[model samples]
Target: MQEEFISVWVRDPRIQKEDFWHAYMDYEICLHTNSLAFNKKSSCVRRRYSEFVWLRQKLHDNALLLAHIPELPPKNPFFSLNNARQITARMEGLRFFLEEIVRCPVLLSDSCLHLFLQSQLSVKKIEACAEGRSRYTVAEAIQSSGCRVQRFCSEEHSQEEGETDSE
Candidate 1:
């Protein structure tokens, strides 16, 4: 899944090598031991690890990271102004760019369970909720969920997550 995501980015003419390198690193950050070419369990890669969705997240994160690069291009017309203003303006554009990326379902699917709970459910309940389980248990269960959408559910709960292409 990771390689496929990287391959797509690498093949795209719009993305330069450095951009793809950063994107690849961001993609690696998003994955676990369940998938990716280097994992021993790679052969058992789940169907739900949608390449499109995974790639979307990679690209989005890369965009956010790159958006922070200081606008220090030596000969830019805006060099006369303070560097802070130029950087701030660039950051604003980057924020908007990220917002557009966030609108895509694939990238948005990378939603963190922690963030979801913190915002929607209160912080106190989250800690109390984890009391009965081994730490690895929940993460393994999430990885086992057949698709990206299903991965969001907690362990000990076995609702069908999604219908994969093989199904």
Candidate 2:
């Protein structure tokens, strides 16, 4: 797999209220392909930029909620217990978010073509073999096929080479 450049931006703002506290964290994940423009005719570049913006907004809302919101876990009787629980929950949320984000690139990119013809032999060599070629030329052609096919060809050729060696 080719290398991918990943950039992450995180912002955390803590707001303390008399009864509770709220913290908002935002994250932006980007991929760089070293192209000035993805496609001149299409809006793929603009769309990617927009996705980053939307992700930041969504994370801010989910992470930095209102202090009084009932959706958050209730405070524990023991301060240490409450703090520990909150920290644990935050870590879990971050782990889940990162796992989800990591999958996006692989799923979004184009990997289908490589999957289809990965085992194919080159067309030119096959044509050359069909013509009147020397034995050595044909043997080299077979050796340069896909890795699995090449292995089989080499093993067969070794048997022939061994017989010649003995004579």
Candidate 3:
């Protein structure tokens, strides 16, 4: 039997016009379930940045390695909400975040992460309480879960290694 693959993407984020100038603009951080898994229905859940943050925090609190959590794009205070380039970059970052969550088996089993990816709740009420096992911190989780992580080498170092090793 083939393993189920979860495909996710972020689409059409609208900036809240009223919050555009409040030093922090609200973002429509959504995940669309382009579900490639068998017998699963495709879904689109509308969420916000805070909800995403909360999910990451929950994972961290549960002792899940943050390296397993995908990074969100950095905030640009100088850029206006309507700037096309900035918006596009943010969307891409959100997409990356979802992709990373789907890729990690440990993260896939997390309740909070599951809701972030598969739940239909609105942003305001998107909290998932701890259930079942005692939630350990990232290090403990790593030790107990036996989840393996690849050493991450940056592109620059990779290029340098290729130059030296391949010569």
Predicted structure with the largest TM-score when compared to the true one: 3
**For residues 54-137, what per-residue lDDT tens digits would candidate 2 score against the true structure?**
333433443343211112222334423235455455434433443344334432221211111121223333233434342434
Assess the local accuracy of residue 141 in candidate 1 as a C-alpha lDDT between 0 and 100. 36
Q: Largest lDDT belongs to which candidate?
A: 3
Clashing pairs in 2: none
Model 3, 62-144: lDDT tens digits are 64464456677765656666688886787777777777767766665665565454444443333422343344432232223
How close to the true structure is residue 103 of candidate 1, measured as C-alpha lDDT?
39
TM-score of each: 0.23, 0.22, 0.59
- Name the candidate, 1 or 3, with the larger TM-score value: 3
Error (Å) of candidate 1 at residue 6 is: 28
Those runs of model 3 whose alpha carbons end farther than 4 Å from true positions after fitting are 1-3, 17-40, 122-124, 128-167
TM-score of structure candidate 3: 0.59
- As for TM-score, the candidate ahead, 2 or 3, is 3
Instruction: Spell out the clash pairs found in candidate 1.
Output: 48-147
RMSD of each: 17.8, 25.0, 12.5
